[model samples]
Target chain A: MDALRITHVEGTALPMRGEDVDTDRIMPARFLRAVTFEGLEQHVFEDERSGSVAGDRAKEQHPFDNPQYAGASILLVNRNFGCGSSREHAPQGLRRWGIRAVVGESFSEIFFGNSVMIGLPCVTVSPDELHELMERVEERPSAVLRIDLTAGTCEIDGFTCAIGLPAAARDALVTGAWDTTGLLLARYEEVNAVAATLPYVAGF
Target chain B: MGKTLLQKVWDAHAVRILPTGQTQLFIGLHLIHEVTTPQAFDALRARGWKVSRPDRTFGTVDHIVPTRERNRPFLDLLAEDMITALEKNCHDFGIRLAGLGDDRQGIVHVIGPELGLTQPGMTIACGDSHTSTHGAFGAVAFGIGTSQVRDVLASQCLAIEPLKVRRIKVDGVLPRGVYAKDVILAIIQKLGVGGGVGYAYEYAGSAIDRMSMDERMTICNMSIEGGARVGYVNPDQTTFDYLKGRPFAPEGEAFERAKAWWASMASDADARYDDEVVIRAEELTPLVTWGVNPGQSIGVGGRIPSVDASLPDQQAVADALAYMGLEGGKPIAGMRVDVAFIGSCTNSRLSDLREAARIVKGRHVAPHVKGLVVPGSVAVKRAAEREGLDEIFRTAGFEWRDAGCSMCLGMNPDKLVGDQVCATSSNRNFKGRQGSPTGRTLLMSPAMVAAAAVAGEVVDVRELSAEVAAGAI
Candidate 1:
């Protein structure tokens, strides 16, 4: 696990292009057996790079090759970003593929929840803000997008925008916390307390 | 003043209703798969806890298992290890698992119902979204995350928030060409994807009542698309008849004892609901999604809505259109597609494939398209193969692969390429859902997708009535 410090990178907006990019495309379905997130970065867009699945040999530049948007990590995508089967590898692939966070106009609820649970910042931005961010990335590829979850702002060039995440989700991302352990530890108490009120829990 | 069916079930299963408006409900049946169980079992072992009810739990080898070859030392090392781990877990815990080569070995949802293990009035939980498919038998089934998977294994119960019941009543008669796949697409269209969040959908009314057991499975399968944690239809004669002769079903005196019990679990005719959304069957048509979400849909024979929305009512319409690269008022039919998939828990039953095979009989695949037909379970595959549905699918240029989640989510080898459009029978038309980030998926019925494959584009099954009406096929 190559642990890198999240350096509060600026958020550049780009309405995620593509529909139904299931795990196979995100990290190739073949890599689901890869035990760990090691060496997954190279397989990010295996379909496009290998020209194996659905190839357009004539087209020189697929979406991933746009020179202006090189090295940008925070992706702004359209609705239903991940809607296929529940393969954890899709998020792992994105996390390794330079996508520190995704600000989507909308997200598959499961994908969004899982991303947050695993420490990936997936926020829902208004459509206008989504479009503006995409326009910014297109206009200036070298332009840094200052995405600060601590400040609740995605600043690209001269524009500063708010990506509205529910406070609970926002707080978890800002503080670099995963509440899975705490939630699990508290379940016994929660169950007992509720059981006391209902009385049947004791019988069970 | 009235107890809805949901309330009745909730009360029956509730160990306690929590202050947070959730319930600590005991699960009657818990199903496990290969991928999600390892971590869950590890979590249990770390706590040194034993499985609470091994007899009530069942395991299966799917998701990670390779569909093609059936030998040891599997090509995918991680999958082989996961399979080995499950075998050990099931053996150690005294839980029964339907390993491959066993007749009962099939997709969790498909086998659960077929073996008569899935009973109405029970709560079924699995670490899979399509667990709702068992709801066709009136069982209250829900999908859980991995951690929740651990909880079920340890305690045979879940801490869950109570769901509001949305009585999604479909009335009148469906058109000749429309199937359950179309019914669900229409429902998602009427209610946005998140419309059913925090709710359980009770499928009712004349249209739903008229469907077969297979069709009911299709409707309940996509409840997740409506953002409902669970969706179900009340048990009726169709559910009873389907279970009567199955392997796991109780027989004779025991059957009589069970049926009487099952009957009592059906929603009372006057059951009240938290919310109700009604749609006339006549208003619905064979529908397909032209956008990234299932909600971005249009009726068969309709044109893709244009993205040029200069007004307010047209905003969502515009967003859908732009993302899909659809031109306003362009007919959805006859639009070119590169692939077609006919399978999923949603529509990979014998009847669904039979309908697709019936449509594609004596037809040649379009030179420009790639089509596939995967059955939902091994039983479904065997039944279809018995009827020689494989030959028809193969003869029509589709790859007749083994039963698994083939292309539904592209977890296995099935997927789409960049910008290539697919007419799929599986649920969800989200962006890149078929494998390529740029790949587009259009949700439709198996027959509709067959039509698209035959025509090399979206074509309404109603127009090509030759297969059903003309009998030329």
Candidate 2:
């Protein structure tokens, strides 16, 4: 993990508009069969789109079938995004799917943790500001959605929109401290001191 | 203040204090399952570590081990690899593994108590979240993450923050048909999901004290759903009676010593609490959730909250209403059900099955709905079948399956097909959590699921119970 560095990669924003979008929709449990955690980009949102074949033709039945937000990365969800199970695979599925970060009005607590743990930056914009961004995404599929972690803003068609993140999470993203094993390792002395007084632990 | 059970266990287990003001606690018992233990065991091996306290640890295979078929190497290749790795690891580390076909094979939580491993005045930690189920015997139990799992495997101490204690007292008595499942669901509704985020809840009051060991386990099982890491009832005579002749429980002279020790763990009558709330058991009703979250619930006779009710969580309510295709203020009961599942680590014990069987005996499941009853453990399965409850379930159109988290989170073969709406006895009701992303789960009691299975609708279990009481069946 690099020391707190943020790089902005401009991409084709594939926005899937919906509410209460859950983890199972993000990654089908069947795909969980493959070991080594690779070859998953094709399966992200399997239940949502039947298959993860990227396309632009709009269909009315499925929520992701909205014409305006095809091939979008920065998902502009309505509210209470990812309100479901604590499966870490949810955010892993999103990252594998070409989605960089979510700019939703709010996120479920477990989803937020899953996102942060897997290095997918989830930036929360105010509901009103988020509404404006979603409107722009819905208004123009080709419009650019720029999320700058350093700037703490998302730009829709060069129009800047503010978002907020907790300082620890923000710093972690800005300075690439992805793995937290070091934090625990650094406290070896402190942890051992506490462990010394216990007997059962001596067996471990 | 005199020591409450919480304080006694907390003090006895306190290893050291960290600068963060949390106590470094020693875990007397550690349980590992196949799902979360592989990574942890790998971490230990990578560090050239041996399991520090193999005697204090027990391993079980349940999550991926299908209750349907326990054949060699497993049907799922990944599950087979998991079991293989776990078997190799346990052999290498000298830790006993309760592999499938072993009498001890069952959900980690269920096997612990049945074997008398979940003793009072001990601090227990496991990688699985429902570890609080062991706390019914007055142990201080909490679920740890994988990293923590590795830590416990390598070193038996957990660097943890001490939680503030809160007392919840339920007075009087519960009305007929209001089981422990309803009580936990009701608690989640009243407290919101996050109300107990940082507190260890001490369930007090007369109702708790009067409950059997099985009943208390149900209440503590959903402590995590309420955002509390730990929930427990004080050890009383009921607890002692239940422990009398278990395999691991002390015997003869040792039993008296153990009894005295267990007695010390109960909270002093005047023990202090950080917060206190009381509920009247008489006021509780059979409860059910109308949404994905456990907190979105109402009593059996109650109507759903209106989106216009001015609650701050209204959007959540709205989302739930929309997902369920329900209009706000509608009654949760009488809704059509396509499936009914009665199993989970949460409520698939012998008592739970017996209660469900009482409702389904001589009755038939609605033609349109499917029903199943999966026991929590092999012991539970054996006991249930010995009593012929399994035949009763089969006779009523309910499938009798072996033990595991079947239909609980849909990790195994049992799952909801398509968009079927299921009345489930599991702990969670998240979207697609029951196997189909579009599938919906209505969390209720085993008895309630039984009632729904027979009626093909979410009927109040009380009405069915009243009829059963009157020998209408």
The candidate maximizing lDDT is 2
Give per-residue CA lDDT, model 1, range A90-112, as digits (tens).
67667777777887766654566
Q: What is the C-alpha RMSD of each candidate to the true structure, in Å?
A: 5.8, 5.0
Which residue window of length 10 is worst by lDDT in model 2 chain B?
B15-24
Docking level of model 1? incorrect
Stretches > 4 Å off in candidate 1: A1-204, B17-21, B76-78, B311-326
TM-score of chain A, all candidates: 0.78, 0.80
Per-residue lDDT of candidate 1, residues B325-362 (tens digit): 68888888777899999887788888999898888888
- On DockQ, the candidate that comes out on top is 2
Error (Å) of candidate 1 at residue B171 is: 0.7
DockQ, model 1, C-alpha based: 0.12
TM-score of chain B of 1: 0.95
lDDT of 2 by residue, B216-271 (tens): 99999888777677899988899989988988777787778778877777898888
